[model samples]
Target: MLTETGKEYLRYVTEAFDILLLGQQNSRHAAAAPRLMLYTLPSLATKWLLPELHNWRACTPDVDLALHGTHAQFDFNTMHADFVICFGEERYAQLEKKFLFHDEVLPVPSPELIACYQGRKLLSKAPLIHLEWVNERRFLPNWRDWFQAKEIEEPEPQPSFIFNLTLLALHAAVAGAGVILGQRNLIANELASGTLVIVDELSLPHSKPNFLAWPQRTLSQPGSRQPIAWPVELAGTDS
Candidate 1:
């Protein structure tokens, strides 16, 4: 019932539509992979997270992680950050938070240093290493805090080294520089390898917990929460 020209036109129209759909499908498949931008302190990334990244890779093989390290405050919108791992109480009322883990602050010294101070109180005998966080607003337990918790009069020992980052202080302690008020969670690997030892079993629970936070709107997306959950799981395994 149809003329040859009409049949040919119908066939061309169908082919054009099929080609458009195929193009769209190819565009989606060829699109750049999804990336999640995560920000945190340099020490935390290097000491606590870096060692565990292989596990993260096995879990999120398809998602690319962009890790940024800094102590400066960041705007989520301006930085295009998907999430931030922060220490202390929640600061952003608008952001959703997930508790990762709590760490205890304690004195850590190299085995060599401990041997040198055998039978003596290392806190009073050995050189003290200090770590002062750049962001003063978030309080991390220091030697003074530990002493106060133990009800011992705090000493005003002049530190041989003063560092503004945890990683630096940790490395110093490992090099037998001094006894550092180390966070257990951050030095688990070092302790396991007998690189550092806890001094006198003295430790104070950090008043705050480390947490992961992100914009509430991110939850509207399908896979947004996926990246957030793995960190929490990893922290649990570390515990």
Candidate 2:
């Protein structure tokens, strides 16, 4: 009972709808592919989880990852990163926080420097390498807090170097630049390998546990998968 024109119109509409559905499915699949951008503290990136990140690539072969390291105060609103890894005591109200692990700060120096300071009080005269978080108000970690926790007074001014990145400080310490307050989790390998030596058994309490945080509303997105399992697995394996 339908005219030829009506039949053609119906056929065309059905084909168009099928194409649209197919296109939508393809778009979703493309979006679901494991592409993640992670913003983290520089210390965590260069020192602690660099190797683990390589391993993550191995485990999730389909993933495309971009890592950014900066101060914890980075603007989350402008960041396109899928996730953030940072250390803090309090969770951001706008983000979903997952506790990764706790870190302890230890004093570290090169082997030669340790030998030079052997059998002497650590703070006797040697310069201490300082990693300064210039923007301390934003919850960036610092060496002052660690010293305070141990009830140690700040050393008198001496020849010193200040670095924004923890890795640079670690490298400088390893290169015999100065004594650094190294994170146990970050410096484990260097300590074990004798590249760096712990000057004392003293460790300072960390300001916060390492955590994975993502935008609260974006938690359900497919790209959010990497942050969840990666940190959990890393922490578990570390223990």
Candidate 3:
């Protein structure tokens, strides 16, 4: 297995090759309409990206867009995306990165589920849908961490449902599977639409943040690729 340093060096090498070839790629695109390839976390793609796509299409009709989704690290060389939405503050030190946003973890359940629970204690005992971080990402925000943040003990396992993807955990909760300690930004539409409602008042902002990253060549030729313009006002509350 490779150390973290080894992984970063590999990313740098890939980016260097991409920059070296960007001019040739740009020239090819100059012959036709501009196009962009974007890779994003699965949850962000389903909850936010898909809902706001019409606006993205309307805003940049001159550009052709293709989207890809995953919860794992991406190889820019193979993905062929102009930019990627990755979870964490600094995925690539050599590549240019922008702070898009991060999630504020909060307990959300279907309105019907809310009806069965009275208070936080009862809610805690209810089925707790969990986003089980896989790979080396176990340190990412989770219910156990959030409980610690609140200065409370971890709840019993309760044979709770576990999912690798946050989006799936949230979907299960919305379908009344259980209460999910969901990211506010990712579930804002459901909260707004009254499909899912907050069960606990306490909110735990994710220790990690999300970011948008692009090659240096992308900034040099901004006209060739337009990154996703996430709405500032619609951004989820932090506290």
Candidate 4:
């Protein structure tokens, strides 16, 4: 019904309008997309976070997650983050702290290490591995502390292997390198699977508690205390 010039003009306008609509849609998607960053210890990442991360995807398909596993505390001053699962008792006084759970440590060793020892005096002979962590708190839970918890004398210094991260110590224990004071809750899977077992039945309660924390100023802080639900979902934790 239109002349050639008018038809061409209408076609041009239609294409332009479509392009603008697409741009608007893309902008809305970009704005609506949620991105979260979390920092946690290597052991917790392997034994806890990673196992449960799939649940988040199933629950909320839109969220993009960035996870960092480390031994030392992350510097929030420079790095932008949503949350952190740190080993301590409210060390960040200014930051809003969500209490996760306290750590329960017991001596754990691989089945191979148990087989290597025929005698009943297993604790005295096995290589004693220790996790050397730089905690903000003064109390350092170690092999001596574990023995003290059982009300027994600390064993003589045996050949020792020390590691900075708990995951490394867990690996060492699994490899039959030594017995490590393992976090029972953290290493529950290993314990359940029979790859690792409690060498000493005594589980010493750590002085400090694990916390899911974020800077008070972070605008994205969820009203719920779950802090990404990294801790509460775990069994035997105070919600």
Candidate 5:
């Protein structure tokens, strides 16, 4: 219904509107506070980070943090995550990495179980509860490793129950299901509440250390790099 010139003019108008809409969308994003997405293991977020979120807020009040708890690796290109907390010294060719902490694991059992075993010399007979590492490739400390660290000669006891998550394993121990080689940092609440008590005086080092990694592109964004720096600054903090 239109001539060639009319068709050209119509196309120009359509392109202009498209460009305007895109600019508005971008402007909206720019006007909003800068938000950073952080991906880490499920248990770390709930057991370690959640309690200390108040400190994080106090430090970076302006920037928003989107904490995503996941066991699976995410693609930076697709996921748009600003940072990742890995279980080991994960070397990414394009990402900058820093060490957080290598926590220790100790045998923790419910107080009720301790009372049951009171005056007994060998606490090794108590049922062991195991936490299955989601990533089989990474070496995480287990009951066998703890026993070796403690120089125990007897055969490692089989786990009464195995849980896939640290929280579940901790809960199982709290419920008097069995003893678990709980990370010292993760079992703070249970220990404080007297629901769980450390079996031995010695603690075994965790096989792998936790690391914080971020893509190089993260540094390019203004006001984005500061929030992530807090982790390294507060490395030894339980929260």
Candidate 6:
């Protein structure tokens, strides 16, 4: 029983309200899908895992992610990414740290190289592949430290072929380029498949835990999610 003008006004208001509600609902759905940027050490990338990367894909299927991998020496402060997976406690003052997995490093080489260098002084005669950590603090996984840890004296000459990244060193060892101190987890498939063999049973204490780091402030964000359960499950599973 309303006038035509009144009915027209009512119709307009009803349509506007419906549009606003629809927009609100769509915004909420978009917010539910986390759009994240992650920074990680190149070694992790070489191992085919990135920060919050695998768990996000596995656990939160709705999340959208982008990953950046750099040498473990990357400067976290310079990164515009939302999260970083880095080593050591000295970095990330304002972030929460979630320990992922630990790594044990062993000297590895191609079977051919091992056979060729057999019965020789482990360090002096064999070509040692070296991984140079851009960040010195995180680069202790080398022949010198591993040898020292096993109480083997330092060899006369250091490694002749030094690479800036662990993956490079690993590839070199695989190609029979040299002997590399490698992480068991990263090279497990090769070791299992016999593509690479542990030259020495002596493993160094390069066993440091990998961590997921995010700003503490982001913890309360609507899209923020943590892989607390995933890491616990992954810890028991081999890296």
Best by lDDT: 1
How many angstroms is residue 74 displaced in model 4 relative to the true structure, after the best TM-score fit? Answer: 3.8
Selected candidate, larger TM-score, 2 vs 4 = 4
Candidates in order have lDDT scores of 0.80, 0.74, 0.74, 0.75, 0.78, 0.70
By lDDT, is 1 or 4 better? 1
> TM-scores for all candidates?
0.80, 0.73, 0.76, 0.77, 0.79, 0.71
Least accurate 10 contiguous residues by lDDT in model 3 = 230-239
In every candidate, how many clashes are there? 0, 0, 0, 0, 0, 0
Instruction: Name the lDDT of candidate 4.
Output: 0.75
Candidate of highest TM-score: 1
* TM-score between model 5 and native: 0.79
lDDT tens digits, residue span 1-239, model 3: 87999999999999999997997787777655576777888778888788887877677776777788887777766656677777774556666676777768887889888778777755667788878777635545677777887788887778689888787788899899888888887887898999998766788766677777777666554444445354332343222
Model 2 scores a C-alpha lDDT of 0.74
RMSD of 5: 6.9
Residue 6 lDDT in candidate 5: 96
| Cα misplacement distance, residue 116 of candidate 3 (Å) | 2.1
lDDT of 1 by residue, 1-239 (tens): 77999999999999999999999987775454466778897878988888988987888776677899988776876667888888764575578888888888888899999988766467777899877766562467777777888888876565568898788889999999999988888899999999999866877777788888899766664457666878888787433
- Candidate 2, residue 150: CA error in Å? 5.7
Q: Would you list the rank order by TM-score, best first?
A: 1, 5, 4, 3, 2, 6
* Cα shift from native, residue 228, model 1 (Å): 1.1
Model 5 lDDT per residue over 162-228, tens place: 8888888888999998888888878887788899897787787777788888888987766677656
Tell me the deviation in Å of residue 10 in model 1.
41
**Residue by residue across 117-195, what tens digits does model 4's lDDT show?**
8654678788899877765324547887767777767778888898877788888888999888888777888988999
lDDT score for candidate 5 against the true structure: 0.78
Model 1 — which ten-residue stretch has the worst lDDT?
A: 26-35
